[model samples]
Target chain A: MIELVYDVHHQVTFRWLIALYFYFTGMSAGSFVISTLAYGFGLEKFKPAGKVGVVMATLLLFIAPIMLLLQVGWPIRSVWNHFTYLNFSSPMTYGAFLLMMYPINCLIYGYFMFKGDMKRTKIFGMIGIPLAITVHGYTGFILAFGKARAFWNTALMPFLFLVSAIVSGLGMMIIILLIRDRFFTREKKINTELIYTLATMLGWMIVFDLALVFCDISVLSIAHAEAKEMTHLLLHGELSPLFLGIENLLGKVVPMVLVLTPKFRSITTITIASVLVVIGILFMRFVVVYGGQVLPIV
Target chain B: MAKTRYAFVIDLRRCIGCNSCSVACKSENSVHLGVWMSWVKVIQKGEFPNVSRSFLPLLCNNCEDPICVTVCPVNANRIEENGIISTDPHRCVACRYCMAACPYEVRYVHPIKKFVEKCNWCLHRVKVGLLPACVEACPAEARIFGDMNDPKSDVSKLLAKHPVQVIKPEIGTEPHVFYINLDNDAIEKKRKVDVL
Candidate 1:
């Protein structure tokens, strides 16, 4: 057997902060997309979560940029450079611009929603839908375009990111509604139909996310030896416990089973499943961002 | 006149791997500790009596199609008129995207300067008509740097005389750093034997 030695020089350049940035940005995008579904598409069953989703998206958007700025060595220079010296070819340039625009649109949409201006809220929702998708999808493109990390170089990456974003967003929305129902809105019961809708949506999103991941691993493992080795590392090497245990088992399969089973689809069980899904998606982001960098290219 | 295309031709047969070039790079650039812009990567293969060691000195390839320049969200990394890939400290946000995009993984964020940095083939020295610190410090004269665009340059002549290979050629970055008489094992992806 040819032993491939890991070189120290190929250590990961990015850390947890970068992953958190991706997580928050993805959550923001997912939440905003959910809001648009209700307000723009006239999904009345989703109306209860629509305003909440926009509010959460706005807050998350504020936090996401802060996470990114913290990782930058020169935060001030980064801000100046992003606006003044944008590279048209880079996805990150588009991401920076999208991050800026999406949140502003969300704030405007939120204002209209708060004022009970359905007409304006719908208009903003229509505009915010594409912005939100691009914002999160662009993060995926940033990784997909890397071309250096064998694990990250694929077209499926953006689609996978989009699905996971929606899953995480739905989970967060359910949790927020649950908390609001219990603590703030004691006089009013949380909508059972809304919870069921989000639970079902989360269930299908997880399936799609899992399918994409399966495709990514199977395709990568078959062709290039380096990619195969990286996939093996994820599946059977040091990352196996995190990847197979937390990400696959707790994050995907168990929650999937809980949400899909009619008997276990109670609010309590659904909440627990949503929490697990959120945690699982976080681990997924960790694997993609950190795990992809673990293997040295040369 | 055609613009200059600078390149490095390393003769692995002659390299002693003493790591003087690494030291020279540190001192010359005042690079911080625990970080490096250039270093020697040692790869050992075979068993006992058959064992052989090869030193692959790692530095920025200054690729013809540098992904670092392409991935930089800001125009911080750019290809100069002479085809040398350079990072402007003033413009760099130190986001380290270039570091991630680089197939060679040769770039780093400077601890103090707060900017992404890598070997630009000692452009200052080149402008002054002198050799890079690593080249000057190589006691074995293993590293040859010159303009590949010039037919009379040492690199051009060496390319004509020897079978040269670039690291990760399948990635197609078109690296300018060429290795002459290198072991194939030295270039293969290394597996981690330990983890933290």
Candidate 2:
């Protein structure tokens, strides 16, 4: 009945650069938690991954903010301006502090662990846990605080982002640890027991993540006019290839089944699932950020 | 003395889908080559023989509770003394958070300068005792702009008599831009070829 003849198309504001930023940070956060398992929580079997986890966590966190810097207009000026003009109420303001503090905490945590200073490592590892959570968690708040985008405006955003961070982190770690074990380790044998344990954790985290995604889409489908269109766009329209095909079916569901099903759980399957998960999480970030503004608001 | 609170009123009855307002706004702001600060969305309603063109002139509402001001990372966005949600051009880091947050989709990144910019109701002109270009250029006087705090202002007069509406009032940004006989269909339909 109604046909749009001449309306300025709303451009996708937060593009793939932001998505890559989210992906890196998510993995960094998840890796930080894995590192904390042995040092902070006394999970001895995960001890081998503890140092590599912290190293990956720190390195990825460092890489994450570069995307933010590049996406901004004036990179050098913004670095200074972001610090000086602190809008504390803004979700992005939370990120400024978290990004700076979390990496320093990781370096400190990793340093103590390397020096055989268990007590100090434990303390910093514990401190870094919350910092890692918030660093990535704040990105979700940025989207959630956007307040207009149908799916991004949900209360479930932060939780959904947090769990996905953990999922991708675990997946990245599995691949990294396996690579490290195969080539870098003194023994040529892969650590099956350790890999299986991490897979179990990845399996469960993905389950939690899937549940959150399900809940989010279900609510959005029935919420408002915009929300309805959002569901339609992602579930069926232009966003379907990215959202339904890549993000859910291939990225999440496939990986979830591979990791969770007992018969399907193997070194090769786990590695494939881990690879899929890391890629999937990246798409999720893309889907969330790009999809937020892809469909015009007014 | 009453504070200046500027509001806009679009009299749709008088609008003839002319691009006068849209062209004036771009020239007034010198908005970069491919971006727009204000533009009119045209929708053709009903089947061929019974078709009628409905226009939705779009611009920043500069809401009473502007989300852009709340969500700007560098505090680049703020409400002016005149109640216009103004952007500090120098401070804007091109973090398009405001662009994403604004339901109106009025904000855009300047192609060359790279800062986020939008229609500030031709703020410079308004401050210098001139009407916003769009208002002055409208042949039918459809685009009405004036201080809401002043009882004698045209906006105040029209608002007092007309049951005006905003684009998405339910979201509660409390838009200062009021429209007479605004078409919801004009707001709902998507552009035929989405560039994104």
Candidate 3:
């Protein structure tokens, strides 16, 4: 008979604040990437959201690094150490550089848009797409490279992060645009077709996100003992309510159904679905960051 | 001119689960409450009459290929010349990447210092030609410490005589700490409790 020992050396070092950092950074990257669809690629469907997306991405990018700064033991020293004592082997060092560069790129993009310089704005948007992807994708890489946590160790982490970022960004854009339409005076009628296009985009992103998560859970459940134990904790253990109910049912499924259904595709329903998607992605970040640390390594 | 590699050899047969070494390490390092640099993990195996309790004293493995050193974004954690992995409190941003990267999960952020800290094989004492506090305080002399490069060292002699096993050998960390006469059951048993 195999006996289980009760060793509790593992304590969660990263907390809700780190989850917030991941959320904001992903949102920033997603919003920027979505902006590229309109500004960089000249997609007429996303054209109306071009300036708003860049503005939202710039604001979110500004907030993301502060969230990280708040969690460090010596917040003041981080600036010096990040530059002077950089370790190229660590993904976090690369992330720091990416975070620094991404916001500046977004700011420059926003400035060109503000000046009505479409040519320069498009050029910057083209450059911003890869920067935005790397900024948030590197966050996933940070956890994925740990190799110590079986749940975090996966080749799919960067892809999952990038997809989720786009989903959350689309969700935020929908809500913000809806609010802007309702409260702020517009030179043109709020484009109903554009809203529908974004809802469809969100629906597909949610589908892709769900598929990625399913792949992750299915693979982990079949092999890898430590990962199986973690999947058990996520699926059937104490975290089941958050993972199954909040993230899957309310976050992904409901939002997908609300956006995709013909009868439920009204403005109010789409707004509600978008809000749920945002909340769900936040919970996903929480689960990914905290759930991975629940199992004791020793 | 071989590089000095310090290591630990613990004879599980001699360990009585007394936890004297834990106390010695705490007092020697002045480690705060609710955290430890070294501690004895007691596991009860089997059922009723067949059951036997075993103690595994857990500490930093001081791995030759220390993941903690590689994962630190600010290069706060470093492997010393003698292969002892140490953390610089001033330099550490305390991002806890080292704590997460460590497969052994031995590193902890000191609540008071707010810096990532772990056992450095009692380098302060070792520099003065003294044994680590845990090794000195072991009443059963269960803990052995020495330079693995020195053929005449007590640890080298004991390793030569006995079949020894390192914890989580598949991790490929090349841990310096080896266990003598340890049951596979005792080493491989999964912890049943939620860590967080």
Candidate 1 per-residue lDDT, tens place, A2-101, comes to 3433234443667888888888888888888888888889988888888889999999999999988999998877888899998999998998889889
Residue runs of model 1 more than 4 Å from their true location after superposition: A1-11, B193-196
lDDT of 2: 0.89
Native-to-model Cα distance after best TM-score fit, residue A124 in candidate 2, in Å? 0.5
Q: List the residue pairs that clash in candidate 2.
A: none
Residues B10-82, model 2: lDDT tens digits: 9999999889998988788897777888899888888878988888888999999988988998999989999
**Error of model 2, residue A156, in angstroms:** 0.6
Relative to the true structure, candidate 2 reaches a TM of: 0.97
The whole-model lDDT of each prediction reads: 0.86, 0.89, 0.86
Q: TM-score of each candidate?
A: 0.96, 0.97, 0.95
The 10-residue segment with the lowest total lDDT in model 2 chain A: A3-12
Residue range A167-193, candidate 2, lDDT tens digits: 999999999999999999888789899
DockQ of each: 0.53, 0.66, 0.56
Correct interface contacts retained, every candidate: 0.50, 0.70, 0.52
Each candidate's B-chain TM-score, in sequence, is 0.95, 0.95, 0.95
**Ranked candidates (TM-score, high to low):** 2, 1, 3
